[model samples]
Target: MMRASLPLRRGMPTSVLGSVSANLARPSSVLAAPSASKFTSLQSNKAPSNLSKRFYSSKTPNEIASEAQADFDPHAITAMDKQSPPEPGADFNVVIVGAGNINFGSDEGPWNHSFRLEHKLGPRLKVVGLIDPSADRAEKVLDVKRKSFVLSAYKDTIVYPTFADYVRNRDPAKPPHAFWVGSPPAFRGREESGRDLEKALVEAFPNAGIFIEKPVSTGPVDEAFAIAERLKSAGNIVSVGYMLRYLKVVQKMKQILEENNLKVMATNARYIMAYEHTAKLDWWDKSQTCGPIVEQATHFCDLSRYFGGEVDLDSVLAHSLEHFEPAGHLRRVPVPEETIAPEQRIPRITCATWKYTSGAVGSLTHAVALHGYNYSTELDIIADGHSLRLVDPYNAPVLYFRRPGDDHEEVVRYQSDDPFFSEVSNLIDNIELGPGSAPILSSYEDAVKTYALTWQIRNRSEEQVRKLGKGPANF
Candidate 1:
C-alpha cells in the first residue's frame, strides 16, 4: 500500500555554502559573545507576535523536489550569501527542545536550526522558548541564535528545564506554533525515552507542528509507534530530521527512477566517520548513541529505505570489526582503561545486508575510526538500466549517474546545498500556509521504520562480538 504523507507542510531553500560553524566547547557554559554581557530570558506578558507576511506555492514531494532542483545551482553565490542573515520575520513561533551540537552546531559546520530558520524565512521566524536539561545551555543557544541572526539583540525567548516545565508555565494566550526536538538517542525511545514528552507536546500544542531529529528512538520501535499514533490523531503537522531526503542530488535521482519507470534493483550506502576527540564521549558509548548505525549512519540507512521502499526486517545479517581486533589500528578514545568496558565501546566497522519488500536488496557499511572531524559517505541506487550515486552529503554534495543509452557517467555537483536549512524552512512553510501546501518528506512514523532497521543491523552484527576466544594484546 502506498503511504501518502499526512498533509504535513514542508519546503527548502537552495544554493550557496554557509560560513557559519558551531564550535561550542561546552554548550552548557558557552561563553557569552565577545561584545555581550550575561544573557537572561525576558518575562513577557505580551501575546505571540503576528505571523510573518509570507506565502508559498508548494505541494507534493516529487513536485517540490523537482522545483528545488530546477532552481538550485552549484556555483551561484548571491550577495545575500555573504551578508549576515536578515531577521526571522516568522509567520509562527516555536520552542526548541535540546541545545546540543545538533541544535547549536559544532566545529564541523552549521547544523544550527535557528540559523537555518532565520536565513530562510527572514524576520518571519521567532523562537519563543527552549527546552533542555541544562537551562544554561538552552539560554546560551538562544543567545547565540539571537546574536547571530536577530541583530545581536536578545529577544523574549525563555529557557525551561524540560518540556514539562514549559507546559506548566506556558501562557495559554501566547502558545507556540511548533517544536523541534533535537535531544540525543538515549532520551528518545530507549532507557528514558521521550514517549511522555511526545504525548505531552501533542496534547498541549494540538495546533502546533512537530519536527523530530533522526533515530526517533535508540531502541525498540514501539515507543516511536505510539508517538506516531498520537500525532496522527491530533492532526499535528509532523516532520523528521532526515534532511538528506531534500537534497537536490537525491531529488534528481528520484526523477530518474520515475521518468524511466524503473524499480530499484539494489541500494548500497556507507558512512565512515572520523571518531576523534572532537565528538562527544556519548557518541562512543553504544548504550548512549546506540552504535554508529543507529545514531549516525542512519542517514544512509534512511536513504536506502527511501529509494527501495519498505524493508524485510527479518532478512538482516551483519558483521563488524570489533574493538579488540587490531588494537593498534583502532585508535581508542582517550580515557582510563577501566572507564570504557568492552561492551561500552562502539564497533570499528559494521557491514549489514537485508532485503526490501519490493524484492530488491540493500546493504550498509558504517565505521567510526577516522582520526579527525570528517566523514566519507556515499549512496548507490541501482535500477534495471540506471545507477545513481550521492557523495559527501556532509560538505559539498554531488551526484553521479549512468542512465540507459548513456555510454559515460554524468556528474552533478552542488556548491553548497544546506539540507538543514531546507528541513526547518519547509516545516515552517507547512505550518504557516497549512498542510497540503507543502510536503513533509520524513514523517515521524516513517523515521521510526528507519530507526528499527538500524537497531536490527546493530543487534545482528553484535551476535559475533562475544565469540572471542582470544583478543588483541590490549590497547
Candidate 2:
C-alpha cells in the first residue's frame, strides 16, 4: 500500500503517467525558451537519465549545412495527402529505414533478416524505398530477395544513404504511403533530441501510417514525448512495435480476466534471454543497448504495464548485479575484450519493483546470462479469486490459469503464431480501414510510458550501484 503522503490524481487512469511524480515535469512539459542545442552539457561519469529533455529549438549547424547542400525546387505537393482506401488487392508502398538486427536477423551478414518484411507482408506491401547510413547495408538489403519473395516486385525498390537523400531524389509524384522504422533505439538524435526519420517521413509522406520498433528511444523522456507529439500532430497512423501484446495466448488471457471481472492485485514478469546466442557485442554494452531492461526484456516490461496498468515513478526501486572475471559465470558467454577493459561494463541481471497509482504492485526480473535459444520469458498476474500466467511469448505462447479453489490448472497453447507478422497485418489493416477505424494495440504515446518505466528501473539501479560503491563492477 502507498503511503498517505504519496500523491495520486483522483479518478485518473494510472497506466499512463501514473508513476510520474507531481514534482517531475509532465509529458507535455516543454522548455520555456528554445535554443540551438536542447541538451545540456554531457556530464562525465553519469549514467544519463532515460527521460532526457529535448526541446524544440532552432536548426543546429549540421542541419543548416545539410539544408544548404540540398537546395532544390521543393515539390508542389510537399506532403502526401490522406491516402484513399486501397482498391481490392492493391499494393501499398512502404519505405524501410534502418538495417539493423530488428530489420534483419542477428546472424553473420546484413541479408539474414533483410527479406523479413517481404517474407511477411509479401506483394501486398511493396518496398518502394530504403534508407540507412550504411551504403553497403542498404544496397545489400535492396538487392537480396530471400525465400518466398516475389521477384518482380523488388525490381523498382530504390535505396538512399540518408533520409535527406531519399527526400531529394525520390519521385515526388510517388512518395511512400507508409514507413517501417527499424533503427536502433539510440539512432533517433545526432547530439540532442531529434526525430530525423519521422520528420523526413512526414515531409515526404504526410498522413502516412508509420510502424516504429520497440523501446521507442535510448535518450530522455522529454525528447520521446516531443517526438510522439510531432507524430501525433502529423495525423499519421502511428504504431509502436510492442508485438507481444498481439500474441493469441496474451489476448486470451485478457479475455479471461475481463470476462471474469477480476481486479488485478499484482504482476510479476521475468525475461531471461539466451545470452550465449547474442552475436552482437554492442548489445552487451549499456551505452549502446541501454542494458537488458530497455533492450531485450522490454517486451516483458511492456506486458507488466499492460496487465498492471501504468507505473508510478515515485514508487519505483531497483537492484542490479554485474560480474565479469576469469572463470566467473561471465566467462560462459562471449564478451567483447574492449567492454571488459576496466572502464566499461554491463549488468548481467536487474530486478525492479514499482507501484501503480491504482494501488497494485508490479515487479520485473531480467537477466542476460542464460544459454541456448529458448528465451525464458513469462508474466504472472494475480487478481481477485484467480491468477494468470503467460510463458515464452516470443517463440511459442502458453497461458496457464488457476482459480483460488480450483482443483486443476487449465493450460492453453498457441502453435506457430508469429506476433511480428500479426503486427504488420494490423498496421496494413489500419491503413486500409483508415485512421480511427481499425484499432492499434500500441501507439507511440502509449509505448513511451512503458519506455519511461524501464528507464526508471535503469536510473534507480545505477543510483544503487553508485551508493554501494561496489555493487556492479566495471570491466
What is model 2's C-alpha RMSD? 13.8
Pick the TM-score winner: 1
Query: For model 1, where is the 10-residue window of minimal lDDT?
Result: 1-10
User: In candidate 2, what residue range of length 10 has the lowest lDDT sum?
Assistant: 1-10
Model 2 bad stretches (over 4 Å): 1-88, 104-124, 146-149, 189-195, 324-329, 337-343, 471-475
Q: TM-scores of the models, in the given order?
A: 0.78, 0.76
Over 225-302, each residue of candidate 2 has an lDDT whose tens digit, in order, gives: 667767767888888777667666776776676667676799999876555645445444454345557655666777
Q: Model 1, which residues run further than 4 Å from truth?
A: 1-91, 145-154, 190-195, 277-279, 326-329, 332-338, 466-475
lDDT winner: 1
Compared to the true structure, candidate 2 yields what TM-score? 0.76
